[model samples]
Target: MNRRQMTFIILVNALVSLLIVLLVTWIVELRRPDPEELAALYTPAPAVLLAPTVTVPVETLPVVGGDAQATPDTGTTQAEGDETVYVVQAGDSLLGVAARFGVTIDDLVQTNNLANPDFVFSGQRLIIPATGQTASPNATTQPAAPGEPQIVAVESAGNLADEAVLIVNESDNPASLAGWRLEREGGPTYTFGNVQLFAGSSIRVYSTSGEDNTIALYWGQLDPVWRAGAVVRLLDGDGVEMMRQVIP
Candidate 1:
């Protein structure tokens, strides 16, 4: 072949090689991910978590507003079918008084905000916070007058709706009882709002009128809110039992 023809062929090959290299470089640049797009794909996002429910014991809760004085018995009677029932008697323990109304011990303590707890006396009136009942307090209280009812009683006559309900027999003469609802169950006595009942905490129970004379006194559980069926150490608040059920 002539030298000129060979040179022409070589030149054509060199140009083709250059074009191929440029095409490959362009394809590589296009295939790389954009920095902005990469950031959007890998950016971190915020997360959210749910809070557990909590129930504040009446005693532990701080008083916000209203009459800070002890709940008073205005020398009035709790007539039949009244929304708030009254228990008139001097020197009655919270548990004993509540039993007559088929309530739980914690209900009375929480409703009344008994500070000493061991020291409730006559003429001290209490507000029944809730029928289902959640409980009380540790502030200073003045001494009571002589012959005043020890505890102003309230009632908790209802079914045990899986909520540690107080079962009362408006006239039944004997009944049994347990203290402290499971925290998860959230009984009215230990649960003020929607908080869960805590385990291993002190709780009280009341008997049904005419239905709970078994011990003739109050019974307390030092720590049993974890599970309802388990029995725990018991004590008498002033007196934690029922002497007899009286019709109101």
Candidate 2:
């Protein structure tokens, strides 16, 4: 119980207390979570995979009639053997089609068996008859002889209101046009009613709906009956072709 003995006892107690505090701090550090391991557990993963991009090319169609240039407003034409085939385009009339191929309207109607000669739709195939070829079995009319009434000229402006055909009587006597027929090839026909043409006198036939007179006769047509290159025929009362003139 002396002073030296008491000092030694206090030193031994302090050493034991210090050893216990170090052991507690070491145990707490081992139980705490690591920063790298906690970040890996909370990170998000992707939901879907990305797809690859692709491209495709378009195709084009070839033109008809081989290398023939397309005509403006008019359709294209192709030759097959000795015949010419014309494909109808948009805004094509039967009169215009006949004129373009230099064929008569009756030739078109008889060759194609057209139920309605005034109606021709787009993309329709038309077989053009050759020049001087007969249309039907009953088309036996011949051209007019000399010293008869002749179709002198055709003034066609591509409109029904302004289209006209001129006929002149070159004989010495006055000829009667009564019961005479003015035919538009395969289209409607205009018959004269009690009309007379004097010697060396001329008359005009219009292709429009109007009152008829001595000099000018109207065909009463809704559309134009004449076009460029169309054939205009003048027939007698017996269905004989008196004159044939092509529109310019």
Candidate 3:
């Protein structure tokens, strides 16, 4: 072949190689992904956490008024009925205390078994009944004399046969046993009918029901009247407390 023809063929081959390289580079650029799009696809989502449940307890409280001395008795319960215990202040009287709680003076006398009704000492405990209850007065009950009936013995625990309460009169003059009462704190009460106790003499009060005589009296009770280690109170004719005897 001629020299000019050989040079033209070499130039055509070089141009063809350059065009093929450019086409391959353009295809590689088009296949590559954007940086923002890669971050949205590969990034992980945030985690969520939850908390636990809990419980709480509540308590109750009593309501108080202005006067501290005049707190209501809403927490005490008695065997006779629902009652409130009150403390007597320095200048407190049965009538005034009754008025404060909207009760009658007779209620205070009957509840506390006041012998003189007019005499009350400071720091003494008194029971005041709830509203709307009338205390019945014993007409035969008399005012208590200073010292007449004495409690000598108290036998509270016997099975209806041997339970007895012994009482004596150590006074100089004779005293009537009529309307006198022998009672337990939350239990039985016995009232004398028509009997006279001579000076320096003694009598026995039985628990079971039977005939009442001069020396022996029947309480007319079937159930147990009192328990051991209990106190028996002796009240005079006027419902005044005279003595207390504890069972052995």
Candidate 4:
């Protein structure tokens, strides 16, 4: 071959080899993905922790989770602010009378001291104690007029500061405060769900089973209530109040 022809041949051969190399590289790239690729884009986030819920420690379960409570009854029947007294009339059995009024037998007996359930005489005025709302056997002193029911005030107080309030019963009524509720207002009437009383409250005797039982109540810093002229009444089962004392 001539020199010029040989040179031309070498250049053509180099160009062809370069093209072949590129084509092979492209073919090798056309492959299926690997089965085990690491997950890099979407990593999971950690879970967050929260504080436990605060509940009232009373006889019944704490029912104040966003529940609108206007009045405070430690397990009394008196609706928000209603109270009354009933007289034991003729033809009244303890069970029959209690059932008619929608109150427990124990509550009726506690309100009215019946030494002998069978021995109650006619026309003996007795306290019928308060409940949510139900019929009565002729109640006396309705709230505003002759037909309206009386409104009784129930005061509940608790401490934001951790401290136990000593309880004393005025009427000696048997009360269990395993599931109760309390609210406290601080810095602009803010209410907080609470467990027990703050520091001090008026303790009185509870009239339970013909006996006087005392209980501890924690309202708040006792001094603030006493200064505010608040009143707390310890009532009997018959709705007859045993004692009414200014918070002191």
Candidate 5:
């Protein structure tokens, strides 16, 4: 072979070898994965769990003076401006409530505007005036006329032996109770005989049997004549109603 041809053959073989090495390096670089992509494939996502919803309940209270049904011995009191609101319990009377709150019957009557001072019912709401507070002017019950007799109180009315009705004579002149009748509606009647209730004096007529006296008289009844929620009327000899009171 010639010297020039041998040189040409060596040059061509070196160029082919260089081309093969560059092709192999490009193929290896294309197959290799990126750092961020490799980490995303192996690492797991964070777990998420939802919680359930919840509910609650609420309580309600009875409004004052709204409910008319009375509970026995169960009463509620609330303070108002310059006064107090009291709920009347079963078997409560005007006298008993007045004595309990250290107020007078006139105070209760004027504040509540009661048409009849002798009548009070359970579940009634009464506004008690504060100390030194003036009574309301909207009173429904007027004071008795001068020189008039009145029924003041009825105490322990449901009790057989302890029940009594009080009668007061506010007249300037002496009052006669003779031939008068004490009637219990739908029940019994008691008649007075030769009795004289003097002016500015009081007397108690008891339900149970006992001897007649100056300050007290007996009905001679075996059972209780005056019960809770009973209407007692005082009638004259001419069958006229002088005064009336309700047992509490």
Candidate 6:
């Protein structure tokens, strides 16, 4: 072969080799996944934690008059001179009756000389020592005018700062939160101050540090206060439970 022909042949061979190398590199790159896509394929899915739920506690009243349809009655007694006679009714617990009449359970037991507080039963008569107290705190005053405040929602599965309970006032007038309390089954009691809410209003109470505002209240707890399978009780000024919520 001539020198020019040999040079031309070498150039063609070199060009072909370069083209083949580029084609191979392109194919390899096409088959391989990008860094983000590779991470998505190999990385595990994030764990999902669910929030807790709330339900009301169960309470059963007594069946009275031997009638299946008759409702149980906790007989109300009027003051006669120095003492009042109270007839125990179904669901007429000592703690409940005392709270209703603004008296302590201890007072009821001591005056009646009862061995146990739970000894009282349906149709049993109890003598209440009168101190000129005629009005019942639970009867005279209520949670709110139109209706009591309700627990609308709650977030109990997060950190202390994120834990919260939402309450709404469905009353006609402004509802005063004075002397109101929020109690947990196995936790501390959170008392409400002089805060008031208007009709059709809502407020959020947190477990962490925050100033008490019109729409929010803080428990100022350092650790997480709410947990799973807990019951939240809302009590009025008379210490009577207005509502209850159970966590799941």
In model 4, where do residues sit more than 4 Å from their true spots? 1-82, 132-248
Pairs clashing within candidate 6: 54-246, 55-246
RMSD per prediction, one decimal?
Answer: 19.7, 16.6, 18.6, 22.2, 20.6, 23.7
**lDDT score of residue 70 within candidate 3:** 52
TM-score-based ranking:
5, 2, 6, 3, 1, 4
Return the TM-score for each candidate structure.
Answer: 0.25, 0.41, 0.40, 0.21, 0.43, 0.41
Tell me how many clashing residue pairs each candidate has. Answer: 46, 1, 2, 42, 0, 2
* lDDT score at residue 36, model 6, on the 0-100 scale: 92
Q: Worst lDDT window (10 residues) for model 6?
A: 132-141
Which is the winner by TM-score between candidate 4 and candidate 6? 6
Candidate 6 residue spans exceeding 4 A from truth? 1-146
Note the residue pairs that clash in candidate 2.
106-186
Tens digits of lDDT, candidate 2, 187-238: 7788988888887666778888788877788878888887655667888888
> What lDDT score belongs to each candidate, Candidate 1 first?
0.40, 0.72, 0.68, 0.39, 0.72, 0.71
Residues 1-248, candidate 6: write the lDDT tens digits: 99999999999999999999999999999998899978777967799999888888999987776667964545766656656778888766775566445554556787889998766788987877564122233232323333778664455434686677666776567788789898776788899999788876667788899888887899988887666656677888999888776654
Query: RMSD in angstroms, candidate 2?
Result: 16.6
- Model 1 per-residue lDDT tens digits across residues 19-131: 99999999999999999999989957778778998997676666657658556555446544564645546745555566545456666667677676556656666555435
Full-model lDDT, candidate 6: 0.71
* Model 1 residue 91 lDDT score: 49
Ranking by lDDT: 2, 5, 6, 3, 1, 4
